[model samples]
Target: MGEAKELSQEEIEKIKEEIERLKKEIQYHDWRYYVLADPVISDAEYDKLVLRLRELEEKYPFLRTPDSPTQRVGGKIEGGFPTFPHSIPMLSLDNAFSEEELVEFEKRLKRFLGDENLEIEYSVEPKVDGVSIELIYEGGVLKRALTRGDGYVGEDVTPNVRTIKSIPLRLLGDDIPFLLEIRGEIFMRREDFEILNRELLKAGQKPFANPRNAAAGSLKQIDPSETAKRKLDAVFYASGLIKGVEIKNQKELLQKIFSWGFKVVPDWKIVKGIQEVIEHARYIYGRRKDYPFESDGVVVKVNDFRLREILGEKAKSPRWAIAYKFPAEEVTTRVLWVEFQVGRTGTVTPVAILEPVRISGVLVSRATLHNFDEIRRKDIRIGDWVWVKRSGDVIPEIVKSIPERREGFEIEIEEPRNCPSCGSELYKPQDEVALRCPNMSCPAQIIERIKHFVSRNAFDIEGLGEAIITQLVTKGIVKDISDIFFLRKIDLLKFWGIGDKLASKIIDNISKSKEIPLDKFIFALGIRHVGESVAKILAKRFRTLDEFLTANPKEIETIYGLGPAVAQSVEKFLRDEKNIASIKRMLQAGVKVLDYHEESEQRKKGALSGKTFVFTGTLKSMTREEAKKLVIENGGKVLDTITSHVNFLVVGDLGDRGTTSKLEKAKKLGIKLITEEEFLSMIKGS
Candidate 1:
């Protein structure tokens, strides 16, 4: 390769000017926040400075890139993946359950290294609940993306990986070195997760169980388009291969990754030894879920990479790393009483009210008691000091009461005789934990139903929380669900803190919600056993609200997933006089009953419609999955290698050479290019 041409003196001067400005701006803020612990600027203000540099990059388009602070959100998620062979295997880390186990790991480390002089310096970080992935960069260009499959061999998911905007397309800015293998955890944001699950419900799909599962399930989508729609991100934690870099320690590597525009974990402090590490561990445990993402535990790794290399591998995992889980933050609190809440599934859940106590950096005044079985098994009683725990930022659960500690004060446990909400007799269903509230018209049920109607999954009415809902009912600003649609902002403003701007936003959201899809409308009705998925299935099957309402229960039950019980619920819900009147009120108020059946039907059809593909080399124009979807929709197949039966081979060079063999064979056998333009065309072809 010939020497690349240098810019003119004027160009160089301008680049120098921009670089100086960026450096001063970054360091000034770093000191103010990191050192001083007093940030004058908000996150959005900091983002503005970075965004300016990015905008400059777009303008100049070819400045000598520096490994400056701003490149972390990655370029554009590249189109296709290229092959990358690991120079060093990115291995897993070992776990330490007890203090004794940690001491054993330390002792084992000394034995492995056979060096008594080793005073191990470690880097501790929160172990986020997410999927692990690898990003490969060669000579500043993003080469490939990989999953930590089996440690040695992994699934080639370049296409799917390309959707993550955080993984750079070509290395952003000055770039780090010739070869860099960045390992990271991919996770979804909490707000994004809530949004996605809401959408999932409206689309008639099962909601993801949790954030970690959501991230895992999202990254594995064969359709890049599907994955792309999900807002997912990656956080770089460790390195696999470093070329031309002399960062001697793990802490430096983390800072370097941050400087190079990788979203490394937050800063860590070094301790003299394990004792300090233990204190730091406790401090982190105290504040674990306070962070944006969920963390199962904290990972303690040997700081020095050279020292780590000396310690080497033990079995499958690196000997240098040990994870310390937060001690379960269980609390002893009093459960004033147990109450049952009926969910969309008709499963009534019992919740416990408690004397407020701070646990795990959160106020714990309530806990889920589970049910009669849990209460009996734990021997929980009123006025008892019951143990409560909140893990990974979720709802708190009661573990047990101190039976032996009971003075004559703790009263006998008694399950409520009747539905607290409806005043009907409460009965425990066969093989069930919850006590049921069969009367749907109960005041509590109506209140909960109203809240659900305005929930993010249903109408998505903003500025309407449970507190506001209660106030609305009391003030008579709203009654039936349809009342929300009929009301005006002037009506809402009568509430105590309701301001002009917020009131406008709420009323606007209400107006906007009138255009909601059919599934949301159905969910807003609060029919028993009718969640987002069932609503969508019904919406698509019936194609119209009128068609669905009039359809016989037998026809409703014909849908594969809809059984007799669900069908009966649907019919019963539609037959209710209140429900019938509510629908009329909604339609009269101009609420849209949309037809999303065509789209939902398309999704149900397997979406691969069943086509397969295999790709090689880097795809510069688009991601592997994006291109794959095109081939799949065109009724073509993609294979991993250039076998005789291979229908097509996407032959493109990223920065790898190993894929040449497959391409050469494809040329001889005339396998096709999952062409960029044609691939895009094919995706929409269906």
Candidate 2:
């Protein structure tokens, strides 16, 4: 090859201009896709742009910059993440769990300011459930990312943060600050977290208990590439240290951050007085699930930056802001018995059978101990009263045992030496905390697998409850999950109490379930670590069962949001002769795995999107529950309390409850009050 010719000054300057153009174009696309959740171009189009930019930067190495979009996943730090002192202390916020406490917080502010009847404007935002970090930007470029380690000092996580596409590598606009310290929360979306846990399980590794844990774990990863795979996101909420620009208030600061190509807290509002703050808190608490990420509470801060200056700081937290926490979804329940249950993977888990208690409307009777180690760590004992917390859709867990409430009757839980289902010797894996039976033929394992295959999120085969599954496994009629497809009505008739009608209905349901979605089919296979969410991702990527089966570990690993563990598990399952045979048998029995299609954008954006509604009093047309369901179905949210954010307040028949507090509050806030008929009409029209 001929020697490469050196470019002239004009050529270099043109190249520089081209590079800047590409960087700006890529940054705009990134902002649109990541920050706005609205992309102007397709993934392939975006990739080409990035590829072109990379090629140009590669040929012109002298023009390469740290703020380039291609520099997202940097080389891993050799030693470990370094620690750095923050420009200003990243103080924690005091918490208030009730309206009264919030009022008290406001009263304290008033008392300190010596203004008795002082009207204060407060900025309210969701307290995002994630790890807190401070980002230092020097001359519009990101300088450092640090975790909130002790307020004054934090561990540098700049490399890991760069991997987050939502977080900008450099500030946009010409009026950028010379030095700016932005504080924000790094969180994983619920959907991403579900997919991640599925991959972790597939790799035979322990899954994160929640999204918050997953975000924290992903942020601290040594490898930037690993962090990039996590699809972590962030939202900048507050500014710590700013040198060039001056912000008047919290709302203005948030807007400034948004203008600088960063996502601020969603649906943040400015309200007058403490009551409005309490109302916002109630609204947030009621519709927390509507958000993509977990939010534990609402952060209420004095809107005026000058007022914040007057309030100053406390020892560990800011006096201007207080976190209005949602009510704990926890209930004290006595553990009746500690039952050892064997999973489909033959892993023995300790489950605490609790005295029946209601938590967030669900009647909880049992909570997972996770493993023997968790039981020991929590010191959970049979007959001991424990605090069972049920957050969102996550399974209720024993937060901690109430040692003070425990009586002499409480018995310390002992690790079982034998599998609960099969009398096999139980052994704990060297690297895992779980004890396994190592028996694939264990009856409990078989029953559990069959149950999982027919679960609501899987094949959804109706009339096949746990009792029937247990009976099928015990009688040796159904040896495996695939056997259920070939079950004859005669075989079901042989079992006692199985009537002709029930058996026929079950067989009909099983037949109807043959034509299932690919994602459901994948989940029904009872593959370890492949949950419904992961199955959907796999289905979308592979499109067909044949494609998935033909895929090797390398091909599978190349897919975004998937790691080696998930790829290996999928490849291993497909390679297994028995599994393949079972799959073939199922196919031969007329199981058709249909291709997956994503929900249309129009359908995803419901008619009542971004609208908040509150229902009060009694309705003659429908129950409150029915009304709330309609709102949710139409992509609207329902809150228990009336706030400024509420678009409509649904009013029912007053009866003896005329001019209720909710109505008065709604009137005070100027929220639209709609009659029951109007509400019905609105939903019907939508």
Candidate 3:
């Protein structure tokens, strides 16, 4: 190779200037293609600019900078994502399913402000159904990106986020804020999601359930290059924490973000009053199907930042904002057949196989009939046209049967008398609509139980997916859930698709799952009526697996939140000799269930200690599970029922509906009723 000549100081400075210019040019082209959807140059031309930038940077490594467009997709992240606290919490919005609820939302805002007839301007934007994320910028340069883990904290996914071309590597304008936290959603367009799923299926990988899921999974990829291949997009809609900028209203804020080279939601409007807000919501809903991305609803917020501040926030959501949810999309499809599937709990669910139809951009081929009773109630028949409805991310369901369109050849779908998989006779429990297979050792039930046992919230064995579990069960290598722990790498390697490396990884994951918390172990058992919350309650009350195993139905029933049904189910499962034997075998196989209350002494004396809470209505800021988790984390208890011992009733938005039975009973019992905001305040203070 020829010796390279060293450049002079002036030449080096010129090269530095050229590198900066190329970065800016590439950024502009990226913005045009991704954000504006209007590229001035061709793809080859854009590639040439990027190529020249890469060559120059490669020749002179000193000229490279972190914010350079070429540095978008960096190396893989090690370990896992680190958690970071949001400067300001990203609260969820309360939902309004109807126009009346939307009007009521404005009424509530007025009521909170003590101004019944006040004229309030509202900003309406499409509520994109995607993963929420926060992008931090310091000194007008992209610093980090975080996923919305909870309202107060998030997971750092900066590497994956940087791969998104739509997001600017650095702020474009000179008037950028010194520090800005832009809040937005990371989403995949319907076309991109379909393409990605197709590619995944081609590669023998599982396809994503929805666009939102695709976006979320892509954002969490360990490698940024993998995330880049997913073609993810983002749109900035709000600001979290900002300095050195004066934004007076939502409209101005969005404009400012756009000027900084961030994509904002294309359709948004500022309306004068609640009526105009309702109109705008209706307009958005009407055009929802025409949008490129998935949007479940329209978010209505107080236009003025001052008004929003004055209105303040509740525990999990803002008081000044509400989401007007569009109605579930309904489509007509013929039921080709009805198939019965057995679940972990042995409940036989009737699934209607329908002629393939597309709803909300997803190809739907099957819809749940819920149960045999529902099938009879709805008079659903095979070979009959039915009205199927699909909401955002929810499973498609048969809304009703169209008897008028049904010909005389249509056959009435009847409940199966025998289990489809094991051919065991099915029986119905008292007051229950579902038919249960009494046989515990049924192959279908065993497969489902093992699947549940290895699920994410249970044992969380990473490689034991459905396909692998099925092969294990069908081959008789795994007869029960306990057999999983005893699995040998040599045995796993004998499987068709299993190689040495995969077998080792699976064995490692299985071994790692042997020691789990008491709550997870209880939930993993696939108990009929016991869920994660119930398991936690049981684990906390019993402290250890041995104590829980010995507890009787009466003792379980006496535990605060658990009712007779749950108690009876637990007692029935534990009292069974076969189940006890399985438990013993699992223990012998080296499973160790940890103690429930393993917190420090200081944590045991948390602020809400000894206090019991019952929640009613829909909470806007967080899900019911999240609220319960918070309560447990803060040394409080959450009960499903309203009882005399309940200390407080945390009431959320009741919408247009009247008071619930729990709310009414809480009122009758004189239980202190606190708002969601108050409940959040208690936890924050703790």
Which 10 consecutive positions of candidate 2 have the poorest summed lDDT? 1-10
lDDT of 2 by residue, 1-686 (tens): 01114677787798799989999999999999999999999999999999999998888777899999999999976555679998788876766756887887888789889998999999999989789999999999998999998678999999999999999998988889999899999999988988998999999887876688899999988789999999999998998889999899998899999999999998799999998888888788878888878887899999999999998975346889988767768889899998988998788888999999866544688898887767887788999998898754456888888899966988989888988888999998664678989777799999999999988768888778888888899999988788989998998888866778778878988998899998889888877656554576688788988887887789767655455656776887888887888899999999998988864565346666657777887654345655665565666666555546678988875532265667887898899999865775565452
- Give the best candidate by TM-score: 3
Model 1 lDDT per residue over 1-686, tens place = 01113666776677768965874576456445533447799989988887887766656555535334443223333322334445567665655545665666677667667875668787878787788888877886666778776477555566666666555555544646888888888888777888998999998887875677898888766467777788787777888878977788877887777766557765466665676677777777777667656676788888888878776664345667877656557778777876667654345677888998866434577787666776787788887877787654456888668877777777766777777655777777664457777766555666777888988778888678887787877666676888888878888788877778768878888898887787678767877656555666577688877887787888877764455656777888877888889889998999888866455344435333444445776443344544554453344444334444455455554231243556676678776657432433344442
The order of the candidates by TM-score, greatest first, is 3, 2, 1
For model 3, state the Cα shift of residue 403 in Å. 1.3
Best by lDDT: 3
Q: How displaced is residue 493 in candidate 3, in Å? A: 5.3
- For model 2, the superposed segments whose C-alpha errors exceed 4 Å read 1-5, 331-387, 390-686
Residue 507's lDDT within candidate 1 is: 80
Q: How close is candidate 1 to the true structure, as a TM-score?
A: 0.51
RMSD in Å for candidate 2, one decimal?
A: 25.5
Question: RMSD to native for every prediction?
Answer: 18.6, 25.5, 5.0
User: Candidate 3 — which pairs collide?
Assistant: 316-621
Clashing residue pairs for model 2:
202-529
Task: Give the winner by TM-score: 1 or 3.
Answer: 3
